[model samples]
Target: MPRVIGIDIPDKKRLEIALTYIYGIGRSVSNDIIARLKLNPGMRAHELTQDDIAKINTLLQNEYVVEGDLRRQVQNNIKRLVSIHAYRGSRHRAGLPVRGQRTRTNSRTRKGKRRTIANKKK
Candidate 1:
């Protein structure tokens, strides 16, 4: 695994995909980073050279947050949402679908095992 901006990116994944593991770096940001650093999008993480690491590190530190800072930012956002009592926040509170997906027919994973209705007695 190659370490980028103090975070280890998995060896086998593409640069964009691997960067997503570090938090805050998604597809668009990864593309921008690669473009700015002149890095190959298809390059495997572990194949990166020392110079590549330096360039990527510089880019991340200069313009983007990763790892611990990114995590804290996300937590703070969630906390703020919860404090505001938004629908998504309520979904987070209830651990159910936030997007108004049909809870009656779907959301088995969130809703857990369904109750079985007993057959009517003859």
Candidate 2:
């Protein structure tokens, strides 16, 4: 495993694919990074030289928000929404679907497991 920006990327995977193991980077971003660094997209991660890794680290730190920073930024955004009492924040607070999905039937993913109620005796 090669460590990129404190995240360990699989050495067996292609450079482009391995880059996606980092938190904020997806396929397109990985491609962009590879292009900017003039690295071969098809090259395995383990093939990277120390200089290449240094270049990647410099580019990421200079231009991109990733890993811990990205996570913290996202959490801050959610916290802001909750502080403002937004509807989405309320849904998040309640652990329900944030989007306007019909909760009457579906949305078990957000709503979690069902708790059945017992019948009242006479």
Candidate 3:
């Protein structure tokens, strides 16, 4: 495992993919970072060296908000929506999908397990 941006990336994953394990970084951002740092995207996570980590950190600081800062910014955006009573906010508050996905039968993953009524005995 190699630690970068406070994340421990698995050695088997490609460097670009492993980079996505950090919050606020996705495939696109990982590609951008690798390009900026002149890193080989095909490299394995375990092959990353100290200077690579430093280069990544520098690139992120210059061009992106990441990890804790990004999380807080997203949380604040949701909080603001809730404060203003938006429909999306209400949906979020109710723990339902905010974008109107059908929930009648498919939201169990988010809504958790359903309870059942007991059968009567003779």
Against the true structure, whose TM-score is highest? 2
Per-candidate Cα RMSD to the true structure, in Å, reads 4.7, 3.3, 3.9
Kindly provide the TM-score of model 3 when superposed on the true structure, using C-alpha atoms: 0.87
On a 0 to 100 scale, what is the lDDT of residue 115 in model 3? Answer: 63
Candidate 3, residue 95: how far the Cα is off, in Å:
0.9
**Which numbered prediction scores highest in lDDT against the true structure?**
2
Model 2 misplacement above 4 A: 118-122
lDDT against the true structure, each candidate: 0.83, 0.91, 0.85
Residue 47 of model 3, lDDT score: 85
Stretches of candidate 1 off by over 4 Å are 113-122
**Where does the lowest 10-residue lDDT sum fall in candidate 2?**
113-122
Clashing pairs in model 2? none
TM-score of each: 0.74, 0.91, 0.87
Error of 2 at 28 (Å): 0.5
- Could you tell me how far off, in angstroms, the CA of residue 49 lies in candidate 1 after the best superposition? 1.4
Candidate 1 lDDT tens digits, 55-112: 8888788887777887899889878888999878878778798788888798998977
Tell me how far candidate 2 lies from the true structure as C-alpha RMSD in angstroms. 3.3
